[model samples]
Target: MILELNDVLTENESHTLSFMASSGELMCITGGTAASRTRWLLAIQGFSHISHGYVCIDGEPLTERTAQSFRELMAYAPERLTTLGEVTKYEPPTVQDVFSLKANRDIPISNGILGEEMRRTGADVSDGRVQLLAVAVLLDKKILLVDNPPKETSGYLKNLAKQGKVVVVTSDEDEIISAADQVVEI
Candidate 1:
């Protein structure tokens, strides 16, 4: 991975992150509260503008064409949660129902089975809604990006890391420094 930031941050501020991983190398970003790591995460997913530098995956620059192809692999679970309704299994539809709507019908996992998985993740299945479904979606992604995961959510992050690479961006130096196989100070 290659993260280049020249003027992306506030004036006179520096922003840069770079990581080259082997097959099982786990990389983490730990630094100041300038959101350099967060910006790097966004750029890796082709979400924000890189004013001066470019991000590349496996030597391939994150160009528009490449982004279109790799978009499906990127997933971000922001710190904020938005809910349209407070639903439950006893209501009009269950958590499984919402999951079905979000996921492709052809997927092997059924709504009921996925709902159980949601419950396993500490997400209340009975009154779960779109926000819960969003979690399910993130779990299925190849590259998961989480910002400043608190202690309560660290379990979820650990689970995601087991499934695939979990990129956590935070200013807490200790967390990233000790938790990751390769720690990068941005």
Candidate 2:
């Protein structure tokens, strides 16, 4: 396994865990209400604080300093959604507004294909944020860390997975589990 965590339990009431991942594999985490699944993923990404245990990526011990580079090789989709530029909900941006960000312009995919992908994701964005995200990950060949993608948004993500590895953090849902090649519980 390229990713592995052993005997990793958290102190904040089941707030920690460990798992394994490898190239060409889609890993999904699922369990009870307080399973600490998200915490495990966050910890792997160096987003969560841990007092014990270790994270090894491709045989190297993961540390605070090395985490940044590892993180750059991955991408995160937060549970909450936001407009790229404007913060207010009232002036909320359409698809174009969020699609025009610096990162979006860097995608290597075709505009038409990317636009179709965004529409399928139900981002309701005409400007193609999801498309850009999908293409960017594909172009960079980075691992993806997605938070609870709605059924409507999963299609695009699934399509992205065909191009790169993905680590999805979901609650006690089985829909995405079927899509995973391996299931790791924390």
- Most accurate candidate by lDDT: 2
**TM-score of model 1 vs. true structure:** 0.59
| Model 1, runs deviating above 4 Å | 1-13, 22-25, 81-139, 153-156, 164-168, 171-176
The sequence of per-residue lDDT tens digits that candidate 2 reaches over residues 3-115 is: 66655654453544556767556677777443255566666677666678887767777788898777666666544445556554222223463346555457656767766
Q: List the residue pairs that clash in candidate 1.
A: none
The parts of candidate 2 lying over 4 Å away from their true place are 33-35, 81-114, 120-141, 152-159, 162-164
C-alpha lDDT (0 to 100) for residue 141 of candidate 2: 39
Residue range 1-186, candidate 1, lDDT tens digits:
223323233222375454564323335656766355555655665666666655555557677888855545545544434344654311223344434543434445666766655555454445433244346353465555555544333444455565556344343546444656666675
lDDT of 1 at 180: 61
lDDT of 2 at 153: 51
Candidate 2 TM-score versus the reference: 0.65
User: Against the unseen true structure, what C-alpha lDDT does each candidate score?
Assistant: 0.50, 0.58
